[model samples]
Target: MLTLCLAVSAHAASPDEPLFNLPLEGVHAFYPGDDPAFASVAFDDGDWPTLLVPGKWSESGVSVSTYVGWYRIRFVAPDDLPAGKLALELGLISWGDETYFNGELIGGEGFFSRTSPQLRSYAPSIYRAYPIPVGLLKPGQENVIAVRVGRHFNEGGFVGGPVQITDREPALERAEQNRNQAAAVQWVLFGIDIAALIFIGAAYFGGVRGALFWSFCAMWATHFAFIFTNSQLTYELGLQSLMVSWVGILLLGVSLYLFYDFYTRALGWGRFFPMTVLATLCALIPPIVFVVRWADWPHSLSFALDLAFQATTTSTMLWSFFCAVVAWRGGVRHAWPLAMSGLVLVVAWMAVALFASTDAVLQWGGIGVEVGAKLILLGAGVSLGIHFLDQSKRLARARESVLSAQTEERGRIARDIHDNAGQSLAAINLKLQSLQAKQARGDTVDAGDLEDALSFASVASRDLRDMSHDLAPAMTADEPLEVLLRDHAQRLGEITGTQIDVVSDGPPELGPQAKDHVYRIIQEALRNAVSHGNADRIEIVLSRQGGGLKVSIQDNGSGFDEDAAMQSDGFGLTSIRERTDLVSGRVTIEAKSGEGSVVEVFVPVG
Candidate 1:
């Protein structure tokens, strides 16, 4: 018969109490690879090696981090211990664990049978307390507590944080408290990452939709995803273990790909062979490690391959650090923040890696390390925000400078044309008229010919004067746009031999810029009707609606397919559209074959 004893930490059972409380002293183990059949309570494991309860196999000199193991402990309940629904607290199993009372399954963290399968694993380190029914405990009789452990990920086996059987309420409260505390770290990092994501969205909406900003944002996002796969966190949140584990694995590969891509973008391609070659080697490391791991080679090959993978992984990581440093020194403004944060996280991870054999260190410090990994993303956020803001400011300043220079140049050109070109044309016209009069003095030319010559000169002079005036249209301060429109419409009607009806209603309270765009829009529409549609009559309507101005020009003549006209290089309509867009207005043109056209524009007025 196997006997085990466990002392109670909460409250030791008194002599008068019923022997319902079982204090586990130690367990008799039939370790994995020993006997798979010894899991039953009826199996004799008295001769097996003894292991302490409330501790992992690593405490018993188990060198291998991952394996399957079974632990069985038997204890006698106090005679006076109450027989009711007791609780069995088995805290924080790393991967998977199942509890059995007297060889019947009570519950499990992660369990899979041949017929049933679990899709994903959950949050890594959640506290668990299984309820034990009164029928399962025997007062003054030997009772067994057996646990099967499956170690698949990260510093494997049952974490052995806490073990006890106590009142149901306390057990539940303890479990809730553990979960809340464990979740705190995840929540902190989650907040930072989510906020950063929102900031990226804000920038996009604010007219900063550059693909480069979002490209690195994706990498930063994926970098923080690795923290979610911790088994306790998964359990706390009731996530699927298999799916979480798979995502965790896939994130590693995606991380590698993004790592390669980040450097590729930073260094650019084919520019420097040494840089590209190094990055290429870094990119190749993941696939090579995958091949080595998947091939399942011989022991020596596996050992050597594992070593090679470790070396390559470490080197690539170091190379990433080096690149960040190089970028920082090369005057990449955002590089230092990223490098500093990344280096801190790297050191934390390295410390964890160095002591992976020490289970206690991993259990105590691993969560902090995971949090640190996510915290580094804040550096990315700050860097991106500063960079985008600075870029926007620079662009704005550059635009203002360009606009100022363009205004100055336009003023100079207008003056030069009015002075030199207009004067020159006027002088030529007068000289031509004088020559025509002199040529006709002695009947050297026919009277009709002289008249035609003078007429051509007069037309040339008039056209030159119109061209000079058309170079730029200026409006005097406090002049309402309605008056300008009336003058322009009257002139156009006389020129086209078309009757243009100009109607204005309500006040014209538009900004100078908006009024300018509105006037140009109407002018273009009227010209297009006369020139393109060969319209004989144009109706121009201007009205103020709420805080905006609406203008419509309708003509009756040979109409056209509006789509074809808009798509084609029709200068009048194209200029109209451009002017409307300049004022952030909407313009619609409706026309069909053999039907007249209507062009309407809306410009907001201040």
Candidate 2:
């Protein structure tokens, strides 16, 4: 007969109530069935050697084999041993073990001994449980517990556990609570991982070109796989599976790589090839470790490699934090959310490493941190999604603005050709025709007339040059936005014969696209002030305010109804509004029948 004693809970004792505790190191062992007197209360032979309970004889450096050793404990109860329906719990055991309490057989895990040569070893994952009836324990009395173990490998016998005596009810309740908590966390993590996968899949398949999103999904997916690998159900199946551990090891490696890879991409640092190599190494470690492990590698080597893998994981997390900090410092606002999530997960890992890494029951740390990890990851994903969404919206707006600017540019080019270049060419043609007529009639050609022809040609060339510069200002490439604005103002001033003042206060950095839009808006405003209002003097102001750029162009000219201008906006003013709106900016126009007009624009820096 084989029986297992199962304890339902890990914490049944209160702070003030101490239970009867026994040390395993003081146990005595003997050859099983060597003598029936071994079970007698006073029949301990002086020659019997000591053996530690809750451990193996081989691990204790003793020369022993299967079907030969017996573990016995002689312990005296304290005055406070609980008086109730007490239960005994011996956590997971392997190979074979038979339990004897006070010279009576209570439980066993396998069939063994001289009377029965049959051996039935259960899977290492299964816990052997037996019920201890009430009134079976004596208080304030010496008690003996003996276990006869039969197994040869490290996976056999009582490897890591405690033989505990606990009150049945509280322990059972606690066990149920743990199961419920674990189930809840597991379901939550599964749901989140699935949802994340779906979301990332949608984004990836929807033409998101970046590698960041899918790699991010892989990271989460691999973690999800890792969770099940540590599940007891998986562990049990793995006992009979050749590929379970291998698959798990491979997934573990991939997960690690994806984690680090996603972090690298999200940080958007330079494309460091060596980081990928390092990530590959991280990805390769688990499979290699598992292969070597299956090949009977040295235990210490396996331990060292496993520790290295764990260290790398922690190091990657730390490096991620560092990268996030660096990114934030470099003005990547998206990094803030990553840093926060990383901090939480890092602390969770630290707590898990400190307290729960070696635990067999729940190998993924405690439930609290497990739940915390899920929540942190979920929140991080949401935050990242929002960030990308905002960036996408901005990009779309910028694209629209650029397209509008292109259209306006084409129209301006056509206008310049017709108004300046074409007219000059036509006048030069007229002058040449007149010269040809004078030569045909033998009339004298005037030097003044030649100079006038030369002057018209020069004006055409000047117009072409100015139009080219306006179309694509070389200064726009590297000059500060204020410089570009000043140049535009100077050019407009020359044409209008009006004094134009450009003043810059705290000129904020702006990208080329934004600068183009701003310049065009100001140009439109200046054109209106001159052509429509007939402005004498103009003032342009550029400044930064609240992490944004502000532009104001004012002119002292005859003004018209502001509402009418907005209602029946000319092409130039409409283009100005479109450009401003595309950049998610605000624009205002103030004008009256007599007062000067002011056009003001505000655009965000983000």
Candidate 3:
């Protein structure tokens, strides 16, 4: 009776035989007879392989193998079933496979395989999954599953489970729902990452280190996007799947190098370039191998190269962790977030590496290490966001400090003028008034001494006025360039007793900042012409030049050497240069030992 039962089971549902009678619309379970060889074989939930019914494969003492041939299964649908479309769900396949149902071809292609170390190595590729649609399976009739799987040197065959059936509507609905949920989660994480990346990029670019830091950040964001898309959450964007995977590895490598440069510069640690280059070369491994595949290289070589690439990536990540630690030790004000983010990313990557290297972890618990990787990426994004906010606040404080320093400097200068020059001028003015009163009363004072005192008072008064002008120029107000320049020239002429000629034309109005710079430049130029050039006559000319205004102050005096004047120990000419620079203006000074000096300044009015 046992022999008869065994024979009945072997040929019970051969390729041409009908399936056991069962409900057409619900789930059913099929279990192969207890073969000791099947005990060690298990399905990869990470990449669930499909089963073939009514078939068995020979196995090595260790595991099942499907290298020799195809496997087939037969089932019969209920004849009373509705006429709607049907589906044969093949959970997953290993390496590659082709499926046929009812003597008609069904969809088949390469699915993500966790069996290969390459697929399992990365955090994004830990999940192995594929779906084949068996459309219109002729409900309530005999159906056959013929799967041709090719495996080499290892236990393979259909190691997963038998096929199942369901109505097309509910099956499609569930599949779509799963896809949507995955996409939503993936995109939410991606959006947060992108926002953090943008903030970091903006802050890095705005700071003193300039575009290099931002470039590193931008590349990092791109790499993260590629990784996110390749993850199990939304790995089905079609052609982009393989491309993004490869590109992500490449960009991650490149970004590591860039980050090395930026980190060193921003943090003042300059010894990390060598390690960065080594890491970059490691990142290049995958793309190189991919390109050389057309050469028909040995599979072992390709595998070795892939391992090397991963090792390099791992090393680079480790180096980043080291750099972060060093930065933290160096008292880098913003190091905490970056260091923590790097540490988390490294930990996440290491988790994936551990799982890929060992099969026992996957065998014991279905949950692979990729979940940790996703969480790590999320954490890194948060860290970056916090870092950017902190940096922005620091910049604001620095700017405030600079402005306060400028205000204090200006106040000190004002105080010095008041205490020394201002007080001396007041006393001189009082003595001059008393002397003039005595002279009018016929006191018979020496006219020469009286003249000398009057001259001293006048000189002191002019010095005080010049000091006031230097401390706070009148041009800071909403005054026109024409008016300011005219007033400045008159004051200079009166003080220096020189022939100062004033001329003006076209566009009396000027931007306030522009006018202020121009007035300061003119003031400096006139002072130089009077004190240094010793010119008896000075001509101040203001005229229109294109969309700007030009003011020329020429003195008929003993001009000094132009080059010597520039290199000399004097701040007057330097101050003129600085004033012109502030307004984006240009200044030209022409002078020689015997020739008169000519100083011209041009300022954009708009």
C-alpha lDDT score of every prediction, in listed order: 0.60, 0.64, 0.52
Candidate 3: deviation at residue 398, Å? 6.2
User: TM-score of predicted model 2?
Assistant: 0.51
**Residues 1-606 of candidate 3: C-alpha lDDT, one tens digit per residue:** 323433443343233322331322222222222122221213212232334332223232212312223445556766666545555544333334445565445644443331222221122112112233434465556565554443322223443333455454544444444344444444555665666566565655656232334544654565565556444444353443445555655665555555444444334343455675766676577566644432434545665675676677677767766766787787655555556766766666666555532333322111222333334344444444444455555445545555544564466466656775666666667767777888899886677756766676676676677777664755576666676666766776776687778777665466666666677677667767787878888888887663467778887888888777767534266556656655545578888787988888876543
* Candidate 2 lDDT score relative to the true structure: 0.64
Error of 3 at 213 (Å): 3.6
User: Candidate 2, 358: how far from true, in Å?
Assistant: 7.9
Q: Is candidate 1 or candidate 3 better by TM-score?
A: 1
Q: Write the per-residue lDDT of candidate 1 for residues 1-606, one digit (tens) a residue.
A: 001111231122122332234445345564653233555789887777666555555556654532456778777777786645678877666546677888777777654431122213442355667888767777789887777765432344556545767766666666666555555555665777788778878877887644346556767666666555644555545664444555664565465456545443432211245444544553454444334333423333434443444444455555666666787787767667667766876676666656654654544456656555554566556666666666566555545555544564466456645675556556667766676786778536556655765665676566556555444453443667777777777767775698888888865577776776677677667767787789998888888653467888899978888777756545256556556665545578888767889988876443
Model 2: how far residue 217 lies from native, Å:
2.8
**lDDT (Cα, tens digit) per residue for candidate 2, span 417-501:** 9998889989999999999999999999999989989999999998888787776843256888788778877887787698899
**Candidate that would win on lDDT:** 2
Q: Which candidate is the best by TM-score?
A: 1
Winner of 1 and 2 under lDDT: 2
Model 3 lDDT, residue 207, Cα = 60
All predictions: root-mean-square deviation over Cα?
Answer: 18.5, 13.7, 17.7
In candidate 3, how many clashes are counted?
9
